[model samples]
Target: MAQRNRTAQGVLAALLAGTVALTACSPPTSASGSANSGGSTKALTVWLQQKPDTASALLSGTYGNSEILSVTQDQLVSVAADGTLEPRAATKWNLSADAKSLTLNLADQKWSDGSPFTADDVVFTLNLYTNPAVKSPLTTVLKPIAGYDEVASGAAKELSGVKKVDDHTVRIDLKNPDVGFMYTLFGATIYVLQKAALSKEDPATVASSQIWITPGKVPGLGPFTLSSYVPGQRAEFAKNPNFRKPVEFDRMVQTLVTQDVATQQLSSGEMDVALVAPTDVATVQGMQSKGVGTVSNEVPGFDRYTVNQRKEYLKEPKVRQGLLTAIDRVGIIKSVYAGQAKPINSSFTSSKVVKDGFATYDYSPTKAKQLLTEAGWDFNREFVIREVNNNAQRQAIDQVVLKNLQDVGVKATIKPVDQAQVTDMLTKGDYDIFLYGGGNYTADPSTNIPMITCANAFPKGANLPAYCDSKVDDLLSQAATSTDEAKRGQLLTQAGKLENADVSHLWIAQPTRVYAFSSKVTGGVRGGDGMFNMLMSVQDWKVK
Candidate 1:
């Protein structure tokens, strides 16, 4: 059981950054790493951002329809462009007699491996996460549910959070009520997994293991199957033949391609369907009615900056607040993202779909300077250091904040690094102010908020900023143990305000995820109310 090397893991993930390289034509890779089926001809073609550990972002819902699955596995929920949650997945749900349990009645379903779907699957999945040996990032997301750790630790006889009485019926027991529970449940963490398949791998490695998910062996209950994985070459998937639901396309082929190549191939009609970004919409859209494809863009999750509170300079509340007031979120959305994103009002996206009543940062240089001065910085003092990437957005933001800090005579230095180095400093707690994004919440605030307590199941606490608040800890503990949703939300709201004011994080804007598709392609896209998770019921999707 060798630990995964941090450096290696970061590098592997960073490789996904170069999506433009994949747009070109190249011979598919050898079968040494491919999971393609034996002589299966039925499939579809999707040009993906990069190769994935399990399924590509297109399959996972992190992209568009794939992003939806992360919110809730049930197909009934939809995310509005404003980043709110709508109904999908479970048709109806209920809380228990003591208000500690939530029971759900699912819409129709089946596993991609053709196994009959059942509540036993849900129970098994949750129980697996509770296992200390499992070591999934998802464990922290499930913290709001009661008795998860107990069952995982084998201290409790059964999982108190989720119980299965029969197929299509799932009951979730919470230690307390959570206001944001439903929103958090919409993401991929809750998607079903097969017990028969999971038993094959080492639990800790399950996060990145490929045996159960290879093209020849995936049991996922998603719309498509892994058809081919030719590393540094191509990845292709086709509709599930045994899929309980009907798919539109007979065959789909995906290449290990990027935005640049895909756009070129698509523009030339070499690629049939693709996601054209907003910046390039002119090229794709210029042909609207004349071209073979259509374009779409929508606001999604809020991407923000994180100050590793575990670091020294950011420990001062004023310094953190200073950074927040220093940048113009509106300019970043308009200039860097080209108006595709909306400046966030609260750390929660400005989208009304979520209805979050949390503290928000109102851009104020005066307030930031006052806070910095209160933290004991004279006009001659140099107290802040910034670690950013070597990108236009990072450089632009650094410049803005640096200029503002100098206005108050507090010297701030910005350091840019390759993504690999950034990852190292972020997780290892080595930076004063690091740019980090991901407070995109949907069902429950548990996964999005980054709160922590002594009872937390995660080896590391949530405040990647690494800040600790006893009151916040108490709230998280009460929320985790309580089955009451109302009380859970109350605690979360209280905690959110405290953290927001402390400025451990500078909440930014809700980014838009826009994609262009061929006129021939028809299916799900981004949501209107909540953040669109792309785990869509795309089996019925087809190309004309």
Candidate 2:
């Protein structure tokens, strides 16, 4: 997932200084040499901020890895540009009459090594993910599978819910009917791994072994094969000859280029595609005017501040609501984001999945003061708002929040901490408040709403606020298992209202994703969870 960081501003400033010199260099030649050079473009070059930790999709959650892994591995399903579920390895699927089980007809496909892609591979992938030895973040997504607890507890070696009906078919029995189950299959967290290649080794070792990280050694069933990888540097991929469809580029290269340097490279034609930061949207737009192609969309995530309810001073709901009311989210969007973000007022931002009956907390310092007075909160104590040091946007928003709270007779200070420390601080209740943002991975509220649920309260889960509510938990649980869309939406709306009333999170804005590519590169699609799915349609990409 793309993290909003303050370093982007510094990166932009540093890169701007050398933009003239970098652009002064000769324009980069096409992958297929220049028309005058009598060579054909055979490769596409892309810029990523960081190198992936591992090529195995199940082991890593970084978007840097997904850019390469999306082409190198095939998922059971694929998410379309509009966020609809589409078949990939699984050609077609049918839900049981009761909706508690799903049967999928696997495509007649072969791994990059020519081994048959069978139902065994799918079963193995599921079992491997559910294995207690492997601490995969994806374990949560597969928890709905029947017998998942036994499998995760090491009491069972295989998941009873997953069975191979035939060589080309697999059935998954869910403990409860989940409408978002298909979406889970299409997520970057789940991808098929060859059973034959991995079954011999301890499942835990496979994720860390060179056999999985090594470019040519990793078995994949996608349109490309990893040719080479250099940590924190670059990765190279060659087209898979056994791919079901034709791929336009013969090879793809992903180079690690910071946000500051990416725009300069894109403008100078040194890079084919790069994600443009919100601060750099204007610069990229200027490049677009000069024929630089661009793709923009709303990613499935939102920026917000989490109020730590565990704090004595913030234990009152009125204090949380007062703070929320005091902050000017719209003004922050305009000043910090430069009007590049959409104001959000609830936990669920997507209208396609959840309805919009959430309570709104518009900016009003007078109302905030009134609430504080009623709550009997003293205006003398200095509250600390911890923000990650790398995110310039959050830092700007922090300053704005500081000023807003001060105006409401509350003394607040901004505490800048390392990005890595924010989570620990939140988990330990070391901070009164913090600013954070990232995707829920899936559009369904069940995937993200749990963050504020009692079960996920701090130390054990991501409920940074240490918030607990039985009604909210019940609403989310009902929303997850109900097959009725209207009923589910109603449940989610109720859940959102309960959380907003508790002020678990002060909903801010939904940031826009912007990507810049050279005119020669075609077929870019922005899909689920930020830019994780940007290269999901790489097979259709062509360079003219």
Candidate 3:
């Protein structure tokens, strides 16, 4: 995981005082004790902020859903804490010199049902994802492969790019060279499913079938297997006896809990681990210092306010720059996050290779006023900033932003809407500015730069800003195909610099993901994207 020192000293007393009434009950016994008590199974209890939408691993698109899927399914490759690729189902892989094809050697493993895992399973899994009937979000990752579009369009039954060489090997042919394709294989969206289970089902409806949605029905090659599931409530997992490595916990319980009360539940020992909200960081840190638990923080993602470039006033580069320079990002971090976050100058804030390479926009109210005046802003027009109401941090930050804009003689108002409505509003280009948060799935710039590219603009894609520059697009394309790491980093650095100069999106602060876990939990339970799966190494976790 990326490392950074915590700068703020948490005010635990004041923060915990508000939660006293909420956590009045006695602490529950640790899951470790239950296992040691000679029960039929040992379990570790975890609390999630929200319930997952689906139990099928491949169909899950949200981070919360990915967390549950990680424990129950194994990808062809796994990402190490330091972002290095490690073999999982595929023991090793060989890429062609031109980078147009890859050959994977399967591991000597078996599915949860003791069925042999073969290259055919890998081919079937990729084809299923690329099938238009399935309409999985993961299809984007495989779309670059040769003949993938044909298969996805229903013109072909199987991807011509994917071929099973034998029982232990498979070859994937790509339409173009993609340096980041190897990393894409490690994502939770791609998983090998037993072909036998889906042979008779319609690919479109497989996600809702009992065999896929019901726990213990779908065969997995993970260290843990789903034992039971309750929608919007909890899910239970048991150690897979056929796993290559010994699993420390015999059972794991995932419970649904709201973010506001997660810290209280953790403090009361109802959960062994819980993702603490930024508002409860101080209390959780205080608990950590008192030996109740430990808190791990990292730059897991970034939050930004995207300026709608399609707007007539925003079309001018100067106006966009003025709006961005007017905001006090540092002040917002200090006031809203209590210094829990760091100000970011670029959208790729979490990327160590490109963040520093981008240009910085220091807080300059005078410069902002000048630029706005030059762009012909009358200072009488009121702009609406749309934000999701559920995000307490963003709501607080928005208030600060409103004051900053007012100070500069620019009129603005905060329009709070349902979290579900924000996306539709953005897509419809109904807001002048929209607040959003996202993280790069992989370490490469190719994973994130596309969001602001012209191709992803509203009505067509996720580029809410509708910002696009041919120069930046060229740089991104060059970076995506480059095999040399240093050259690729240089190209991406150039792209970041271009995007920063364009001022399409006002980069705010990179939020730290705080994970509070009981001291009893030990092992390599760290790394990867903090927001997705903090327990990526749960197989190594041993409760004392």
Candidate 4:
């Protein structure tokens, strides 16, 4: 999945200056030519910020783990470089007239071990991921499917909605209509596991086993197969002979290194691909000017502070609106991101709703004070804004926002906490507010609109604010099931307006995610947000 928040502590000045030596330990450079076969000598060296904790086929909960696991697996559908749906394992698909069922036509392909790829594999994947014992994030997103609740709650071990129509076709029945259900299958987070190889183990407990990391144990359908993985140090992959797509490179070598070290390695040509941090954007642009490599910038999501509506002072809409209005968003963008970001109001950035007039929450101290006073503001109470303690950039920005709130007669201060504490606070709703970010990976409005629904709040769903409004919920429900595009747009626009009016969250700026790639690499596609989607076309990437 495209991550919502990517907060990390900034590196020391000594590290950024490259005075303190750190090694990526990249593999020996190969000849400068393309490799057509697995034995051919062409190779690519990639750098990741950290080592993946787990490479389980069931859970891709962390950052670097998703990319490592995704390259070795194939899903039913993949998002193209142009942000449109493209067929991968499945050749094509059709939704029923009522939009309650979906049918997929599988391609004539084979796993790495030469087993035939059929509808049975798809059905197995659905049942495995939905099993409550597996504790996969897919359990929540796939809830729209028929019998998903039963499977997710441990009431049933198998998903009754998924069925194999034939050797090459599969049918999925949904309990209710969902127009954007296909978008949920974006290959970044979800993947099809080999049923022939994995069916022997308990689906609930297989993720903890070493089956995925062991070479040749888990037969993959991707262009490359895992050759070796050394936990925190490095991982290597070789071309898969049974893959349906063309493989341009003989092998891939992934090295785990920090962001500061990655920038240094890319500049020295030790690494072929590395993600560039916002603080090092100028340095990479300088490298680009010197013909070292290229930099790609994308805005796939926005940052914000999720408010807990259960708080007495925060329960009122005016108070929440006032808090957002007082913040100097433009100033923060300039100081924090160096003018690389733009102030965003709505989470649905790609939709017409944002451009057509969603609330901007423009900085207005006077208006903010008036709104706060009208809402019976509690002057004696101090608001604690919780965030990751190690993030220097976030703390600097939060300090500015805190000052803005204090200037408007609001008592507020920043409380820095670790990642574990942040998670606890969000789950228990134990804090006044917390910093976070998120955005939909697909173009459909249903992917985002349903996130704030009442049913999705806290214990029931992942809604951070725990907000509920019957009007907003109905609008989103109608939009998701509507067949008319115009009607869907109208309904979504109305829902966004209501959500913004209620000030469900204090919206912030949309940061531009940057990455550095060596000039010798070509055919690379920049997918949105995280590394998983960004490297979806690794099979087509070539070394000159």
lDDT, candidate 2, 1-544, per-residue tens: 2221101110111111101111112233333333223245377777654445554555534455556667788888764434456688999988776668989999997899988899999999999877878755445557778999888787898999999999999999998877756554444347788888778877777666666558666678888898877666666778898887778777777667556676887787777777777788898889876568877866555677777788788878888888899999999888787787888766654454444555578899999999999999989988888765444556778889899999999978887765334435655777777765654333455545435668656544445567778898888788778888898888877887777787877777877768878877766445332334567667767666
TM-score of each: 0.76, 0.84, 0.83, 0.86
* Cα error of candidate 3 at position 182, Å: 2.1
* Stretches > 4 Å off in candidate 4: 1-40, 80-82, 153-155, 207-217, 295-297, 310-312, 352-355, 389-396, 420-422
Candidate 4 Cα lDDT to native:
0.67
Q: Pick the winner on lDDT between candidates 2 and 3.
A: 2
For every model in order, what is the number of clashing pairs? 81, 9, 0, 2
Instruction: Assess the local accuracy of residue 20 in candidate 4 as a C-alpha lDDT between 0 and 100.
Output: 12
**Best of the candidates, TM-score:** 4
Per-residue lDDT tens digits for candidate 1, residues 1-544, read: 0001010111111111211122234624322123453343433344544333343221111122222223123332333334445444456766555555667776566666667766776677777666667654445546658886686576884567777767888877776765445444543234466667675767666655655335655366655565545554555555666555566665455555556666666555556556555466677766556445553544333445556666565677667776677666666667666777766534433222233554455566788678777876555645444444323444555676667666666666776555434435555655555554432343344544443333321124234455666776676556655556566666666666666666645656655554555555655543221112232424444545
Worst 10 residues of 2 by lDDT: 5-14
Pairs of residues at least 3 apart in sequence or in different chains that clash in candidate 2: 5-391, 5-392, 6-390, 6-391, 6-392, 7-390, 31-41, 32-40, 32-41
Stretches of candidate 2 exceeding 4 Å from the true structure: 1-41, 184-188, 205-212, 308-316, 352-357, 372-386, 406-432, 440-443, 457-466, 524-529
RMSD of each: 6.5, 6.1, 6.5, 5.6
Candidate 2 lDDT for residue 495: 81
In model 3, which residue pairs have backbone atoms overlapping below 3 Å?
none
lDDT of 4 by residue, 83-157 (tens): 467788888999888888999999899998888998889898888877777765445567778888887777887
Poorest 10 consecutive residues of model 4 by lDDT?
A: 7-16
lDDT per residue as tens, model 3, 349-371: 42535566455678999999998
lDDT of each candidate versus the true structure? 0.49, 0.67, 0.65, 0.67
